[model samples]
Structure formats: C-alpha cells, structure tokens
Target: MSGNEISEVAKGFTYLEGPRWHDGRLWFVDFYTCTVNAVNDDGSIEEIAVVDQQPSGLGWLPDGRMLIVSMKDRKILRRETDGSLVEHADISAHCSGHANDMVVAENGQAYVGEFGFDLMGGADHEFANVILVNTDGTSQVVASGLSFPNGMVITPGGKTLIINELFGNKITAFDIEADGTLGNKRDFANFGEIGDEPNVAKRIEAATIVPDGLALDAEGAVWIANTVNQKATRIVEGGKVLEEVNTAPDGIFAVALGGEDGKTLFLCAAPDWDEGARSKAREGRMLATTVDVPHAGRP
Candidate 1:
C-alpha cells in the first residue's frame, strides 16, 4: 500500500491509545475519556470497559484476557470476563514515571514502559525504563536508565525486543532471553541527533515518539508513530527509514496493524499544547492507512 492512498478508519476520539485487533474488533483506549472502546468489523463502536485511571496501553494474555495500562494510578489493569477491572500488576516499585505502552509475549509475559519522569504534566522529571510483568503477578525491571521509554514490540521469533526512546530519538534493541529477561541493549535506529535543532526529539514530546506505541509488519519492519512529526514511519531491520506517512497535525501517539488481512494501520493521535495551556480539546482521534503487509506475531 502506498502512503498517498491510505484512508481513515474512524475519528472523533479524545486522546486515543492502545489499539489492538482482538475478538474480531478494534480494541483501543481513550485516555482522557477513561474508557476502553471497540470498533467492530461492521463499523459499529462500543464501549467495552471503563477505568478511573487514564488507560495508555493495551495487550492480551495467553488465555484471551485483556491487559490495560493505567497511567494516573500507575498500575496494569486486567479486564475480567464479567467486564470488571482488576489490579493485574503494580509497577510503581520499579517505575519512577508512570506506565505507558506495553507488548505481551506468548508465554504471558508483558513488557511495559514508563515515563520515568513526568512528561505530560505531573512533574519535571527524567529517566524512563522498561519492566517485565508476568500473568502470575510477578514483576521486575528488565532495563533501566532510559530517557522516556514509550512504544515496544517483540519480534516474530521472540529473540529480540525493540523500544522507542522519546527524548533520545532512537529505537533501542535488546536480546530476549528464554526466561523473559532483557540484555545487550543497543541502538536499533537513530531518528536524528538529539541536540537542539528541531529534529525528531524536538518535534514530539519527550518520550512520546521513540516508544509511544508501535507495531510490527509481516515483513519484520517496525512501524513507529512519529509523535513530534505527526507521521507514521516504517523502519527496516537495520534502522533504515523506508517510508514516512503523514498524519493529522496532532501528536501521533500509537500505531497498530489490523483489519481482516491485517494490512490496515491504525493510529492513535491526540492534541497537546504547551504546559500552561494544556486543555483537552480534540484530544484523541483514530487515523488509519492501508499497508502491504500483515501484522507480525499474534494480534
């Protein structure tokens, strides 16, 4: 699919995040609205669950349950069959910042990222990190000293994991061990140099790009939501930018590959103003494009 011909799937949301193809529907989060919504194949939208805390990320357990990332309360929430939310994991112990986006593995292990420091509005802080949480309720920090870790994905073979560092303007990779541990951290792709000149880092909010929300295509390419630039970019295995698809003027927070054939790319975009005038007007909206490949790994 060419970037010039991509189309929009749905709109009219406030701060949308965490879009995943589950149960034949498009499941996502509206952070400002504090609700989890699903867009059915027939184009009908439905609210699936609600949480007081702002939901930032979404994932599924091995048994088909949903795991949501709650930012305000700093917790991972699990949605029960009866449609109630439960404390699946408390990550405040290892996270200096709030929890953001997450990716789950086949063994039921979820890799979550944190703001490390307040990026949105809580506090002026720094340092982002990644943590590992199991379905059994055990949690641990797998990587640290990161500058606002955001989006993440485990490769199809499950041998490696890639994370985006918002302030760093780079994608970092780690070797995934059989026990769900991370090692050998290295830069996978560098969006641009980190210093002052209006580059990738200066475009998006700190820790909003590199790791905001990400998806993997069937060809093993990583589709990154370029938050600052308001675009979706495809990166090959060697950290090369293959294509860049422009989105709305708002910040592009996350991206997901879904659709019947898994060729549709969904984007979670939101409006963000300067700190002092931060108001939620048109906060979240869903943008989409058609791609040539399907989503990699499990949906």
Candidate 2:
C-alpha cells in the first residue's frame, strides 16, 4: 500500500496487456493466449471474448457494448449484448504494421495506434499513424509520423489526448477537436534523452525510459510502465518523476487504476514477452498496489 509494496492478485497467462477497470471488474487481454478476460473481487476470472488474431486494448461504447483491439489483422472488434463479436472497423490498410492499443471516447469514437514496422523480424523504425475509428465503423488517420504509439488516454475534460511513443521515449499530447481529429501535437513529457540509434531494436533496449502503457491519476500525473527497465514511474506533465516502483522478475506492460474506491493500481506483467518466449510459457501475472491518488480520465 506504500513505497512500492505490491501483492499478486492473479497469475498464469501468456502476456497480458491493455488492462482496464470496467463494470466493477478488472479486464485485460492475453496477447499470446488470444483472449479477453475479467477478474472480479472474489478472485474469480471469466473469459469475456476470444480473438483469433490476438487482442490488446479494452473499452466500452456509450451503449455499454465492449470494444476490443484485434491486434494482428488491424481490426477493432465489438462485442454485442448477446456475446457476439463483430468487426467495427478495418485499419489494416491504414497502419504500417500491427495495431496495438486504443482509447475509446464517450461518444463511441476511438483512437488506435500500431507498431509502425516489423518489430519481431528486427526491421527498422517506420513512423506509424494513429487511426480514428468512428462509431459507425468508418476510419481515418488522425495523427501520423509517430514512433510506435502504444497506450493512450483522453483527459478527464475530454479536451486533450495523451499517447505514449515507446521508441520515441516521450509522451505526446494532442488537442481533441470537436470533429474527432487530433491537432497541436507537442511533447507532454520527456522520460529521457533519445538519440539516433540506427537499430530500432537496440534503441529500445538501450533506452532507460521505454514507456509502454500509462494510467492517469487524479493529481494530473501519469504512471508509466517502463518495459525496458521493469519499473513504473509517476511523472507530471513536464516530466518530473514523483515516485517509482520496480518489478524485478517480471516486466510491466500496462496499468489501470481501479477498485471499490479507485485506489488500486493494477499492473499487467510477465517474464520477458518476446514472441518466441511468451508463446511457449504462461507466466503472466496481475499485480496490485494501493496509491494515495485515485484514478482520473478514461481507460
């Protein structure tokens, strides 16, 4: 509950990511296992949906239906009331690589990002686009020229959107326009000094602040999951580190603030989630810790 003290809540998964707290439960996606799952307070877990190509982000439409990011095929799938999965939007043609994470708005619109290159094959870096998928199943490239945009969130007032660029080593901010377009792009926080590393994979490996996922707190600060160093950092908009927590054996991919009082910080973590390694083992875990500030903003 204080000073990096954390306890295990759930375990046995093949790489967990895109965690969220919705409907009084914690929801997440197991990338290698290809399933969307939920865990309740009673230590019971339920499979909510299955994604053949794998799933990442989790959110809900204004109508209460669920929206899932189908990573491989670059599609967003929506679950209906009767538990049927339907294609909401196709972003395969728009993205340079596999889609990763998303943030759904209260109006049912979503902003999604992709890898921007063949990462596993060790391809070089290529800027990716953040696609805006409308509620009616139409899509458009809202923001472009990003270095692997990963986790994202809309501010509590819905006026700003913050996105974590994994390889870029910074969190980018955008002004949310009325028409669902992103503008006024700027660096919200600089986790560390990023240099020109010709090798994309090596850049990520060398960077100390390789942020993956993010969670906004009521104090207007963001908690970042630094995948490279296996640490979680709480930083303000101008990049001041307020607090940090370390996960030694396993690395954290994503985080969510949830619980009865919204004080629990749930972390999605696993032991080295490279494609070859994670596919062969199920060592993912959901860890939780208490914090002083409650959650704020969207999932």
TM-score of each: 0.89, 0.97
On a 0 to 100 scale, what is the lDDT of residue 79 in model 2? 100
On residues 155-199, what C-alpha lDDT tens digit does candidate 1 reach at each position?
A: 887888988777777888899998999999888877564544333
lDDT of 2 at 164: 92
TM-score of structure candidate 1: 0.89
How much is the lDDT of residue 17 in candidate 2?
A: 94
lDDT of 2 by residue, 1-299 (tens): 12568998889988899999888888999888899999977898899899999999878999999999998899999999999999999989898899999999889899999998988877888888999999999999999988889989899989999999889888999999998999999988975656656587777776657888889999889888878677777889988888878887678889888897888988888877589898888898999988889999998
